[model samples]
Target chain A: MPLSAAAPRRPQAGNRAYLFITPFLVCFVLLFLLPLAYAGYLSLFKDQLVGGTVFVGLDNYLRAVQDARLLDGVLRVALFFLIQVPIMLLVALAVALAVDSGLLRLANMFRLGVFIPYAVPSVVAALMWGYLYGPDFGPLTQLGERLGFAAPRLLGDSWMLASLGNIVTWEFAGYNMIILFSALRTVPVERYEAAAVDGAGPWRIAWHIKIPALRPALLLCLIFSVIGSFQLFAEPNLIQRLAPTVIDSSYTPNLYAYSLAFTSQQVNYAAAVSFLLGFVILVVSYAVLLLTTRRPRR
Target chain B: MTTTIERPRSRRRTAAGSHVARRPRSERRSNLLTLGMGALLVYFLFPLFWLVIAATKNTGDLFSTFGLWLGEDFSLFSNIQATFTHNHGEYARWMANTLVYAVVSAVGAASLATFAGYGFARYTFRGRGPLLGLILGTIMVPTTALAIPTYLLFSKVDLVNTPWAIILPSLVSPFGLFLMWVYARDAVSDSVLEAARIDGAGELTIFFKVTLRSLVPGFVTVLLFTLVATWNNYFLPLIMLNDPSYYPITVGLSSWSAQAVGGNGSNAELLASVVTGSLLSIIPLIAAFLLLQRYWQSGLSAGAVKE
Candidate 1:
């Protein structure tokens, strides 16, 4: 990547150069490529009582277009994307800016503390939050009761989605903060001095200079968060055992495909669901990447 | 500077108040920024604090105790014993399984990524552009979407329930390859390879003796990440492994917690065990984080270089 793009490299790799890459390519095909191809192939066939794995052509997709459960799951995850990602990114951007301004004392402490959650496994973090979200004995619930309010129902039907958002934001906001902060570090100090001499205060400086410099990092975080929205399996799936009434088996598309293949034994339909979800994510990521890259970054 | 604010300052101003008056507006804003960052610190660390202390209490006190305060009864020792002894010592087995999976996969992956990364960086080969693009494009695909299909693929080969199911896929990190490629382009110069070639060293010998020496940091970075990832993985193992013995700590802990509260509420005291079990599972990872934090920062920044 450090090599200049306009310059041509002298030929050093012989035909045997592939020998170095063969191992990775082999595993890559078996694990990534083959499974994707197989999922596509599986989606084209439907298991019928009489015909047994008949060619459905576009039939599975046609059903998917009308599948309420899949649509509902998609909508819920989409809602999560709209709400959670922005809030998380904003918080991240704020903290990153605060630290980069050379204003926060013990900045490393804040940075590491915020980032510690990213180190915790999503499962363990979910379980920890799940324990705290318990209505009966959960710390949050009891704390609420003691503070002159009724016990809060975090896992209740209306609040469950928000609760999921809080957990995800807590987990990743720090990570995004670090990414943004790294980009902020690369900004020249002269930019700041120039802004300061213009009588721009800290907030105005952040608004005008630092945030603009963080555009690539912010775009990167946005794309990753979007992909993460579609990949919202672990948090919901792990917490389902806590609130079975609110979180159903097919709570998210990933969970739906999981239950279909493993529990309902509908592998063909499940495969189709997986492919459809993958397609949606691909299109969205491509569009975001396109929109960001199409314009010249200042 | 002091005299400049003296005239405008109020007559009631004390010595420290005059010092504060001497400060620029932005300097005072930094004090507020410090407090704001402190608040963010607590927000991030509070749950981890809760997790640590909650593991110390017996089951009955877990509900009765205040959120932040420690319970009157400290039973962390017994809880640890119970955690290790739970379900006929399945937690220990799960921990062992996790260690095996994380280590094997990290070593395999780092090695493969290093080799592939070196090849991609140093060699100009046919179809490299399209091939690298295809691999880079895979980075956008959700890993969850690939799991079900991957399960289907493994089932055909009769490796679904085995440890290979977990280890095989962990070996194929597109990001790791990309990171190593970037690291190698700068770390390993073309002149060194040419000098080695003129010295009549084989490509493999040159890579092993010359290139690999300079690539330790990249390898270690990849190793640490893959280790953490495989250790924390839940979904793949949940679907892939049905046997209790093969369960990693992630799946095993969830199963334990599920039974502890489990709609039926069969094991009330099991909550203590679950809490303790959760604490033990993350201790190694947390330790890893604290020890190698610099690597984590560098690893991520290395990834900031995009195509």
Candidate 2:
């Protein structure tokens, strides 16, 4: 029988619907699925000298586990979280509370002013801050000289990591504040009024009412901050050109991966490292999301 | 209980509520806190204010003028002219490329994500939950981790230097997919779909005609979020594009800064371009937000709450 006659009379709704979604499906598979599959395949092999990259199953994963640079990069980002996330989130929470209080004049001005940094591209922000951190011609170094206090080199080994953390915190605190403030808004004025009637002071209210209500939002910021911190590349990579001694080609894992793939031209090993890193991030992020998103018991 | 209300009432009776509100012991404390916060806000905004003021001054004034203060000469218009004229209008080209990339990717991604979301929400397909979970799992892969592999893949296909390099990645936003799924689930009622079905409407018709109409707010929300994300994307293009002409504004400005630091030319010209470019770059986003302020502000809350 002819296919036109044999098929359902209604223009094949399944085919039509599938066709409607094919563009997305096709693009997703091409970009994400294919790359992921390729990464997985590459991860199972190692570069063999004579065989010219023979299949050495599990060798890459074993090497990744023992890699000193990867381990150091992981520790560095862990230290970053220990120092950065708390301070940033605390400042953001404070700002959000101040803005939400409705007591402060120029609320919108302050809000926009603070949030403006978030809109600035991180590359540009890093460059601008890099200029300011310059020991020779920068405003900070100049100001320090005028004040007669020897300002430590901000991008030096002893202080470069902290300096980078400061830049990250500065650029992102306001963005997190917007998220936190928006979350605070959903807590209802009635809850505050009720607290006030109960003789709760502002401090008491913040601790008991606001902080508790902001748990989920805080978790969200932390999760994202962790992911963002782990993916540190552009800032340190750009800054590396300025202070070669401080940041190596593999200062962070992403930069390491970049150097491996592009500069070193070791695409297969780079793919392995990328997949390994991706898996680690995936586990950590999902763990955080799962733990944060679970409902609180009544 | 009554004391809280009575306190404000008594405070209202005093002259200069602003001053009176600052006089009491408790009020004075709060005032100090507010003033401290105000100063912190200024610290946060200083860079932006520096950009604005510096944009007004020429090369000589940029150095001679006080770092934090405005200069006597206002050469903002001249600066703008120089920014456009230098490098054969590279900045303008970057602006056009950025607009095309952002608009097309944002619009394209949002539409695709919505359809995916609707499919997940309305249809009962095999392995839907696991597929959704896999999609969500992709979000956990820190984007930079995939940069190397993605670059190699694109390179293999000879798409490394093209705009498609950026556009393709932008269109596969997993967060947009997740958001649209949530929105479609809550916003589109099954009863409405059933009613449409009883009226002889097919699934495609119901989705396009009924569900999509009700999903306007969601569509706008996804569009705005994706737009901002695409506009701010730097890493992808930095890795993909080797040519300066193909550079988006973010990458283009960064390159200019690098050239300045390298002593390739007058740093002021590049700095001026950055200042003008940033101010102009934010204009469209600000305008979009202002125009859709109500919808967008609520959308942020909706997104945060749903999480």
Candidate 2 structure quality by residue, lDDT tens digits, B105-159: 9999999988987676555544556767778667666777766667777887899
Residues A197-222 of candidate 2: C-alpha lDDT, one tens digit per residue: 67666667778998889887787788
List the lowest-lDDT window of 10 residues for candidate 2 chain B: B1-10
Clashes of each: 0, 0
TM-score of 2: 0.86
CAPRI band for model 1: medium
- Native-vs-model 2 lDDT? 0.74
Best by lDDT: 1
C-alpha RMSD of each candidate structure in angstroms: 6.8, 7.4
Tens-digit lDDT string for candidate 1 (B1-307):
1121222222312322333345466567778889878887888888889988998999988878886779989989999998898779999999999999999999999999989988887888788777877887887888888898999888978999999999998899887898787767667778878899899998899999998977776788788889988998888999999998999988998888788777764787888887788888888877887898655555555455333
Reference interface contacts recovered per candidate: 0.61, 0.39
Worst 10 residues of 2 chain A by lDDT: A1-10
Q: What residue runs in model 2 are displaced by over 4 Å at the alpha carbon?
A: A1-23, A45-51, A145-148, A188-190, A286-298, B1-30, B60-65, B71-73, B263-279
Clashing residue pairs found in predicted model 2: none
Per-prediction TM-score, chain B alone:
0.88, 0.85
